[model samples]
Target: MARFTTSTLSKYLLQAQVAAQALHTETAPVPPEVHVPLRKQLKDEAKKQKAAGKKKKKNANNQVVDGWELTVGIEIHAQLNTAKKLFSAATTSFNDDPNTRVAFFDLAIPGSQPIFQKETLIPALRAALALNCQVQTVSRFDRKHYFHWDQPSGYQITQYYEPFARDGSITLQARDGIAAEDGDGVMIGIKQVQVEQDTAKTLAQPGGVHWLDFNRVGAPLIEIITLPEIHHPATAAALVRKVQILLSAVDSCVSGMEAGGLRADVNVSVRRGDDPSAPLGQRTEIKNLSSFKAVEDAIIAERDRQIAVLETGGVIEGETRGWSIGSTETRRLRGKEGEVDYRYMPDPDLAPLVIGDDLVSHLRESMGQLPDVEVDVLIKEFELTPKDALSLTALDGGMRVEYFWNVADALAARLGLDRIENLACFQLAANWILHELGRLTSERSEAASEELGFTEDGQCERLPVEQLADILFYLHTRKITAKIAKELLWVVFRGTIPEKYPSVLGAIEEENLWFDELSETEYAELADEAVEGQEDVVRQFVDYKQYPQGKLMFLVGRMIRLGPEERIDPKNAERVMRAALPEKYVPALKASD
Candidate 1:
């Protein structure tokens, strides 16, 4: 082999350095990702599992390694998507310039005390109810002392000891857990859900000094703490993702990981599988896991690190660690803080929150339909399977769900809601929105198109909700075949005038796009046209009394292009075809012998 020249070697060195950096950023896989293009695959799989009312069997990588079991509990810091801060009137809008969204209370000026905003309780109660938590009739605020770049007050207001709610649970699928053997799947325990104020953001400076952006200071937060119910990284990631979706569904928070709408701190520990209920070993906290994929990776790396340490007769340390993307391992950041170090105490400035039954009832009544409840209603009223219903109402199925309701309303205007005839319309709408539209929109390749890139949000925005309903209406009425529906949809997707409904109708008529309204006589003409070159088949039919069913259908399919938008009656077309043949070819009934 030829050796590299000095110039080529220099180029090689740069590439090698870059390759090493890329390796450092990604850690060992928990299960070699279930599929590639990480985020979307996990999301799609989660939807499939949720709809099926089941969890996947634990992946082999998810199980214990070297007799060691992983115990994980994730703490979700969900920032409330409210108009103002938790306790201040300053706007929480992300549109403002840096450091502009701040108040006197945020600065921690002397004699400044927080006065509560009553509206914050709306989302708080909604989220608690959604989580199946027991909302406390009364909850108190407390002070947590800590020093950081953002907390100018030297302490944070929170619900430390007696949080706003407790004793809630969310279902998950763990490798080995109490619920797994019971045939109920794994149920992760919720220790508490507390309302608190967030500290300011920090920026790096030229020297050792830090820059504090107080805009985020005193922001409202709901900390959901789990009770060591999760046992695998994938399970933990799925559960946290579900929580984020639930928060968004209820309008409790934005749940955007990059913008810090939601953040998770996953605590990982290990114990021997021989005694599953044994006290867990010392734990390490993987702090601020921003994405679901990151959560899965961090847990696997940290667990492997712990297992390797213990396998060598070394003890696992209880400390805080950060997963470095450039290093692909959990780096020691700082020692973990025990609860006693925070010096939690009651806050005298704010009055204790008293949530009465009337308020709870009002809030519950005002709330929109939750995903689970919506799924049930669709199953019964719409004649959908549990899986179909669950998928339609899933938190990630935002566009589909919204389209379903609005499409129903549009169809109801055309076909009365209570009429039995409208059932066809309802089913058609759901099928298109849930299945066909997704396939069509996702295949669009134009970079500038609305449906160009498939997003992790899992909602397709190819066409306006109303326009889609219109397309479904045509399909429901048998005006178009499933294939032709895509043509009309593409037109709508590309059309500049979204509001001009007549223009959509004009395009269909002008292009002769849909064969839906074609009469029986017209279809026979198409069938006649299809059989034009088949003189041999015609001669055979004239001699033998039989025209092959498969041959006839193949001809019809070729002639009409069998689209979704067409109102095609096959029996009628076949009848016309039989009549078109001469009397000599007509089959004669045999006389009784």
Candidate 2:
């Protein structure tokens, strides 16, 4: 029946911890920086008596079926990909040796003072604007007092009392199979976005030793907190991914969870009772979830765990839990602390941050086309389906936007902007990019990352927009079939263009010619060869009229693949093949149409 929210439950524990501090010789008034280990150890030992190793309740796996209202909120810490740290001149480079990238101010050395970096505000402003947040005219820095192994300065410089932006919203695009949970047009409210400095990296050794690396000490970070409106795990994951893409587009963060630069903290609570307006249950905080998928899984695991506790007549304890990848369960990390425990105060070293109309307007005009704008253009103007448009932008973020832009540019060049404004040309370009280029390019990216040592973001190094444009233009103008377009995109990505595809000049006759430059005569020859030897199909087509249009397409498509990689325009080939199917068999094409 004991609950953490009631101070009476933890009174003696706090008293004992305070009394025990005097026995240690680690210096009384211990800077709060050196006493983190003892506090962590105390929190650990206390959880052992509270059923630490108990498995999740198998009987109450269905939270919804068992009548529970689950509420979830997400907190994302995005490490801005900036040139320098937020409050120091230290370079924000990852993978550097431990303690090497630290600036003098990062260590709080003598005569050191925090110098605010104005350039670091660009990405933060861009991200805030993209999310529809109201940028504050003035914000301030607050020192968050804490004692952790990773934080050597005994506190973190953050936006505690006031943040850069607030009261924003993100409109979830229609269910496009990517994240079906956050359905169409659902607008998730943004609480606030705060710019802060990251802590150092803590490396755990084998024998209970922890080494602190100061390389990440002063790195700039932005925390995007959402209002507690999420009810499903899939929706939570969707919001996380959308924010990640938005950050990547604005150069706010690399958004890579594996690199430890981007992480998420999920807060979940479940309500079950006869009353609909009962006070919200005590929320458990899940710490440091990295992947988007992991966010979904951890939310579901913790939600069920909360329900399991409630159904068993057990009070839900307000605490922090860590998601375990190996066990697929949430393990207790430590007792949760209220806002008062952090002792937030105005930081003396730094002054209040102020932005004017000119600064806000500069960042506003500097932002490129956002996802919503791109989707509207792709759908309303280009006449693409909502699914295809969302797929192009959401799946790969900035790179996909760039790729589609190149496709549009190539189309405009080939057909002129006025002519390419029609639905057919735009739809062709969209479909080819989403279905064909999307699949093959992903494979190429993986290969490049493994073989060429390219960064995850740099996997598109070989994908020159001009070269990709060449392939897309062919499909847009009906100059080549989708099959030929795919082949051209793959070959062009791998090597030089305007040359024979095969390595041996004469070993396999001549190499395949590029689709864009193929002659019309070549298309006719390929079509003639397709229906040349099929007599039975020809009889059925002319005399009996047995097969349907679907059957005809299947046979013709298969026949097209038998020949060399010539510039055989599929539309031209289909027309010519039907034209040569004798005058009587023409009704199969016309009537079907």
Q: After superposition, how far is residue 339 of candidate 1 from its true place, in Å?
A: 5.1
Off by over 4 Å in 1: 1-61, 172-184, 204-211, 324-328, 337-340, 379-391, 395-400, 409-428, 434-466, 476-478, 481-484, 494-503, 516-593
| lDDT per residue as tens, model 1, 49-71 | 67878654443455446677888
Let me know the TM-score candidate 2 reaches against the reference structure: 0.72
For candidate 2, give the lDDT of residue 76.
90
Location of the lowest summed lDDT over 10 successive residues in candidate 2: 28-37
Best by TM-score: 2
